[model samples]
Target: MKSEYKANSITLAGAIAMGTGVMIGAGIFALTGQIAQLAGPLFPLSFIAGALVTAFSAYTYVKMSNAYPSAGGIAMILQKAYGPTTIAAAAALLMALSMVINESLVARTFATYLLEGMGLKRTGWAVPALGVGLIVFSYFINAAGNRSVGLFSIVMAILKVGGIALFGAAALWAGGVSFEAATDGQSTQIGGFVASVALSILAFKGFTTITNSGAEVTDPNRNVGRAIIASIGICVIVYLLVAFAVGSSLTLEEIIAAKDYALAEAAGPTLGRTGFYLTVLLAIVATSSGLIASIFAVSRMLAMLTDMKLIPHSHFGMKGAIRDHTLIYTVVIAGFLTVFFDLSRIASLGAFFYLVMDIIIHWGVFRHLRHEIGAAGAVLVTAITLDIVVLSAFAVLKWQSDPLIVVISLVLMAAVFAFERFYLRHLRDGDAHHDSHAKT
Candidate 1:
C-alpha cells in the first residue's frame, strides 16, 4: 500500500503563533492573584524566573529540532534518543492526557468569565457547555488542517497579547506601577522564592508546543529554533510588564479575594467597568485560542504517531463511516473529561507532563550531541539542571499538600513506559517475521 503521509508547511510566523498562543493564555489573567498570594510582592520576579527556565528548555528544543528537523518534533527527538516505540507510547499518552485536561480547564475558565460578564446568576451548566462547545469547535478547526489553525492562532495571539498590554498599561496609568510591591511582602527565604518561581513557570509551559509539529514547519531546523527563542523572549517581557502592573495596581489581599475573574477585578479598579468587560472578553478569546492550539498540536502528534506505526493505523486512516465514528468517539471522550475536572488540577497535571518531556529532550541533546556542544549547550545544560532542581522542590511542596496526586502521576507515567516496552517487543517480532518471509 502507498503511504498517505502529508508534509507539514508551517512558516516561522505560524510556529511563533503556536508557541506564544500556548504560553499566553487564561493563566496570565488568573494566576496573578494566586501567585501574588504565594510570593507576595515578588511575583514579578517569579514571572521572570519562570521565563528564564522556559528559555532554557526552549534552547534545547531549538538545537534538537535544528539537528533532526523531523515533523514529529519532540517525538522524533525521543525516537532518536530512546526509539520509536518509546517515542510513540510516551508522546501519545503525555500529549493526549495533558491536552484533554488543559482543554477542559481553558473551556471552564472561558465559560466562567463569559457568564460573569453577562451577569448570569447561575453558571453551573454554562461552564461545562461552553467547554464542550469550545472543544468541538477546536477539534473541527484542527481537522481542517494546520494552516487554518495556525492563521487563527496568530490572530488570537495578537489579541491576547494586546489585551494584556492594554490591561497592564491602564493599570499602570491608574497609579499601579511599582516593582517594589511584587516581592515586598513575600518570604525572602531562598527555598520559598524558588518554589514560588516554579509555580510561576507553569504559566509559561505552552511555548514548547512549537517543536511538537516539527514535520509540518516550513523550515524546521531554522524556523523552529528561531521561533522558540523569539517567542520566549517576547513572553518574558510581556509577563514581567503585566505582573508589574497587576501587582502595583491592587493590594495582594484584593487580588487574592477575587474569585471568578482576577484580571477583570484588577482592571476594574483601574479601567472601571469598561476595562473589566474588556479583560473578560480577552480571557474568553485567549482561552479559546489555547483550546484550538492544543487540539491542533495533539491531533498532529496523533498523525505523527500513526505514521511511525506507534499507534494503530486505523487511528490515522479513518475514512467515511470510520472517520465519522472516530470523530464522535474522540469528542465524547475529550468532552466528558473536560466537563468533570477543575482547571487548576488539569493545569498542574499538564505542567508535570511538560516538565518530564523537557527533561527527556534535554537528556537527548546531552546524550547524542556531545560533540556539537557550544556556549549555548552549556547554558542549556545549566538551565535543565536548574529546572529539574526547581521542579523537584515544587513537587515536594505539592506532595506535602497532596501526595496522592503526585504518586498517581508517577504511577501513570511508569505504566505508560511499561506498555511501550511490551508493544515494542511485539513490533520487533513482527518485523523479524516479515524479513523471514521476504527471504523465502
Candidate 2:
C-alpha cells in the first residue's frame, strides 16, 4: 500500500533532483580534497574522468530499466538475471548495505561541516552525536512520505546547486588563486590518477539511487534512464567547477590539510568569514537532502527484498508496511556506522561495496540477460572491465593505506552471502514441509 502510495508521484525533475542530491551530497563537499591529494593540480580532470567512467556504469542500469522498470531496481535486475538465486539476493543485500553506508557518510559530512561552521572542535562524541542527529532528522522527514522526499529533494537540490555556483563565482572573483600550483608542471603517476578515479567514481555513484527508486518515478520506464544521465551531467559540471574553485584558492597542501572541510576552508580565503558560512550552509543543505533521498530509496529497496522473500522481515510491532520496518532498520545501521567510523573509512567502505556490487550487476546483465535487456555486450564488458581495474587498484591502495576497513568490507560481503545461503536452505525445507502436508 505504501508502495502504491509512491507510484507515479515523482516527476522527471524530481527524479533528477533525487539523483543529483545524492551524488553531489555524497561527493563534492567531502571528497574534493581527498581527490586533490591523489590527482594533484589535475584534480578537476579526475572528476571529468570519473564522469566518463560513471557513464559507462550507468549504461547497464539504463538499459535494464528501459527493458524492465521496477521499484526493486538492482534487486529486480538481479532476480531477472539470476532468477531469485543466492547470487541475486546476496548482491541485492550488498547494494542495500552500501546505500546504508552512504547515508552514514553523508551524515558525518553534515556533522563535520556544521561543526566547522560553528567554529567548534570535532572530538569525542560530538561529531557522531551531530551525525546521528542529522540521520534522525532525515529519518523523520523520510517517514513522512515519498512526496515529501521528492519535494524536499528538489528544493535542496536547487539551493545547493545555486550555493555551489555562488561559491565558485565569488572565489574566482577574489583572484589570488594560482592555477600554476594546481598543475605545478609535475609528472603525476598513472597509478595515482587511476586511484583518484576510483574514489572519484564514488562521488558519482549516487546516480544509482535513481535506479533504486525507479518504481516510484512517474514514467519510470523512460525517465529512470533519463534521470540517471541528467543527474550525472549536472553533477559532473558542478564537481568540476567546485574542484577548480577549491584548487585555485588553496595549495595542494592546504587542501589536504583541511581535506575533511576543504570546501569551507576554500571559502575562508576568497569570501572571508561570510563565504565560509555560506559554503558550510551549502554542505548542510546538500548532505541533509542526500540523507533524506538515500533513506527513502534504500528503505523501499529493502522492503522490496522482503516482499520477494529474498530477505526476512519483521514488523517489530510497527503499524505500517514493510517499508516502515526497513526504514527503522536502515537508520539504525547507518547511525551505528556513523558513530563508529570516521569520514575516510565510511567513504572507503561505501566505494568498495558499491564497486563490487556494480561489477556483479554488470556481469549479470552481460552474461545472463543481455539479449533480453537489449544491452550491448561490448558496453557491458567495458563497464565490468573498468570496474575491476579501478576496484582492484582501489583495494590495493586501501590495503596499504588503511587495511582495517578493507577487512571489514570483505567480511561483511562474505557474511551477506553466508546468510543468504542459510535463508535459502530454510526456504527449501519449508516448501518440502508444505508439500508433505498437502499430500497428507
Candidate 3:
C-alpha cells in the first residue's frame, strides 16, 4: 500500500475551495427546505445560530491543528486527548461515518434535483441510479490525484458560488425584497427549531474536512485554520441569502412541500422555469464538486485511521496505495447509502453521528487537552454545551416525528463503540504508537 500523506499537495486556495466546495455543495442545496420544515418561518436564523455554534466548535480544532498539523487531524486530536483507546477510535470513526453519510445525502440531493429539472417523476429507480452514478463519477475525479481534485474544486467552487449567489439575489429582488417570513403565523415547536440547528450544523461540518487534509495543505499550521474559518464565513453568507430567498419566494408550507427540491421550486416562482432549470443545473454542479472534495477527505481520513492503526486495513488486492483502496471504500459505502436511505433519513443519521462525535471532541479538548493544546476552556465548554442541547433536542424531535431513524442512529453508535472496544483489546493495552506521546 502507498504511504498515507503527501505533504504540501494542497495549497491554501485549494484548501479553501475544497472546504467551501463541500460546505455550500451539501449545505444550501441539501438542507434548506429540511431546516425550513423544522424551524418554521424563522428557519433562516437557524443558519446563523448554527454558524455561531460552529464557530465555537471550530476553536478546539483550530488550536489543535495549529499546534500539531497532521493528515490524521480529528483522530490525532482525539488520540492526544484520550490516548489510543476505544473512545478515540470510535469518535473518529463517527466523524468519518458522518461525512460518508453526508456524501449520500448530497448524492441523493443531486439526483432529486436532476429528476425535477428533467421533468421526470420524483420517485422510482432513476433517482438512486443517478445518485450512484455521480458517486462513481466523483471517485474517478478523486482517483486522478491531488492536483486534479484541487483544480477541479477551485473552478467548480467559483462557478457554483457565483451562480448560487445570483440565484438568491435575483429571487429576493423579484419577490420584492421582504421579510414576510418573520410575520408568519405558524407556531413551530421550539425543540424542533433547536433540532433544526443540528442539520444546519451538518451543513457547516465540512470545515472538519479541512483538518483531515491539514498535512497535505501548504503551510498546514496556518492554512488549515484559515481555510476552515473562510469556508464557514462564506457558507454563512450564502446560506442566509438563499434561506431568505426561499422564504421570500415561497411560504413556509410551500418550502416544506417541495422540501427535497426547494431551490428549484423557489426559482420557478420568481425566476421563471428557466431559472428553475438553472438552479437545478447549479445544484448538480455544487453536489458533484462537493462529492469529489468530500471523497478526497473521507478517503484520507480512513487511510489515516489505518495508518494510525485506529482501524483495520486490508489491501484487498488494490494495486496502488492504502488511499487508493480507501477511496473505493468511501464511494462504495456512499453509493450504498444513496440507494438504501432516503434523503431525510440520511440527513438525520448524519446529524446524530456528527453531533455525538463533536461532543466527544469538545469534551476531550476541555477535560484533557486544553492546557496542552492552548484551547480555551470556555469555548470548549460552550461547544460541548451547544452540541448536547442541539443533539438532545434533535433526539426528542425525531422520537416524536420519526422514531425509527432515532432508534437506528442510537443502535449504530452503540455498535461502533462495542466494536472499537473489542478491536482495541488486541492492541496490547491499546497504546497505539501514534498515541504514546499523547496526553490523557
Candidate 4:
C-alpha cells in the first residue's frame, strides 16, 4: 500500500502565495491590452467583476476544503460527496484538458517574449522548443517535491508584482493621472462590457489552484480559505492600478495596434529600454511559473483519481523508470499542442473546461448543503447563478463566432466519460477473473 501523505508543512503565507503567484501571470501582461481594446477604460471594472465572481466560487471551494482537508481538494470532495465514477470522469476531463490548453497558451506567450528578447523572428519551432524545455524542467522540479516548487513560485511572484508596481510608478511619474483621458471615446455598451468581463476573468483563473491542492496545504480549512481571499484581493488591486497606468500612458488606438504583448511595448515609453527588457523577462518568469503551477495542481488531481480506483492504480505511483517517463510524455504532449494551436483557441478551450468544472463544483456544494440556510446558501446560490450566466454568455458568443470549437470541446468531454466507463469495467472484470481462479 502507498503511504499516506501529511499536510502540516505548508504555511498560510505559502498558500496565499500559491494562488497569488498562479493568478498574477502572463495573462495580465498580455491579455490586458486585448481586453482594453474590447471594453476600453471599463476594462478595470470588468476585471473587478470577474474577481467578484471568482470570490464567490472561491468561497464554495473554501467551504468544501474545510469540510474535507484531504490531499485531493475539490476532486476528493466530489468523489466523497457524489462517488468515484462521477468524479473520475469529471476531474480527469477537466484537469487534463484545462492544463493542456493553459500550457499551450503560456508557452506561446513565452516564445514571443524569447524571440523579442533575442532579436530573432518568431518561427514555427521556437515555441515548441521553448514550451517543451520549460515543461520538462518544471516536471523535474515538481517531481523533486512541492516545497522547492513553492519556494520558486514565491520568488517569481515577488518579481512579477514588483515589476508591475514599478511600471505603475513610472506611469505616474510620466503624468499618467488623467482618468478622463483614459475613458474618452471608449465603448459604454452594457452587453459588450459584460462580454469583456468574461475575457478578463481568464486573468484570475489561477486562484483555484490553491483549492485544488488543499490536501498539500497546512491547516487547509483556515489557510486555504484565507489564501484564496488574499490572493484575489491582491490581484484585483494590482490589476486595476496597472490597467489605470497603461490606459493613462497610451491611447486606445495605440493599445489596439500594439496587440501582442502590448504592456511591454507601452512600458518602453515611460520606463525606457532597460525597463522594457525587465517587463519581458517578468513575462517569461510569470508564464513559466503559471505553467509549472498548473502542472503541479493537475498532476495531483490525476494522482487522486488513480488512488480512488477511478482509473488504473498503475497510473498513480512513481515506479522505477516510469516516473520520469510520465513526466516526459506530458511535456511532449503539451509542447505539441502549444506549437500547433492559436492563443485564442487555447484560451477558449481552457475557459470551457474550467467553467464546466466550476459549475459542477458549485452544484456539488449546494447539493451537499441543501439543508443550510442564510449566508452559506446565499453564497452557493449566487455562485451557481453567476457561473451559469457567465458560462452561457461565453458559450453563446463562441457558438456564433466559432461553433466548431464549441462542438469539439463537448465531444471531447463526452469521449472522456466513455473512456472512464470502459476502463473501470475492464478493471472490475480482471479482478473477478483473479478471484475465481484463486477459488478454483
TM-score of each: 0.87, 0.95, 0.94, 0.89
Candidate 4 ranges beyond 4 A from true positions: 1-4, 143-147, 179-184, 313-326, 370-375, 428-440
Top of the candidates by TM-score: 2
**Candidate models: Cα lDDT each:** 0.70, 0.85, 0.89, 0.72
Give the better candidate number (2 or 3) by lDDT: 3
Task: Name model 1 segments beyond 4 Å from true.
Answer: 1-8, 85-88, 121-126, 144-147, 178-189, 215-219, 313-333, 372-377, 434-440
Candidate 2's C-alpha runs over 4 A off are 1-7, 180-187
Count of backbone clashes, every candidate in sequence = 8, 1, 1, 1
Give the alpha carbon lDDT tens digit for every residue of 1-440 in model 1. 01322445667887787677887886686566656655666667878888878777677777777777766666676777666657546755675566556666677777778887888753557778877988888778767755787678889988887778777877888855655354445454466567666657767767657777666678676887888888887788788777777777676666667634677777776788888898888888898888877766665555556566665445345564332334445566668866765555555566677677667667766766645633266876787797788778767766876676687678877887787777777888999999999999
Model 3 steric clash pairs: 2-321
> lDDT per residue, candidate 3, 1-440, as tens digits?
23546888888988887777778876788799899999988999999999999999998899999888987789999999899999999999999999999999999999999899989996779889999999999999898887788677789988877889899999998997675565668876788889999999988998888887788899888989999999899989888989999988888888888999999999998999999999999999899888888898889889888888899887887798888999999999999999999999999999999999999999988888799877778888899999999999999989999999999999999999998888888776556654875854
User: What lDDT is reached at residue 102 by model 3?
Assistant: 92
Which candidate would rank higher by TM-score, 2 or 4? Answer: 2
Model 4, 319-418: lDDT tens digits are 5433344445456667777777766667777777877777776776577644442237788889888878877877777787778878988887777777
Of the candidates numbered 1 and 3, which has the greater TM-score value?
A: 3
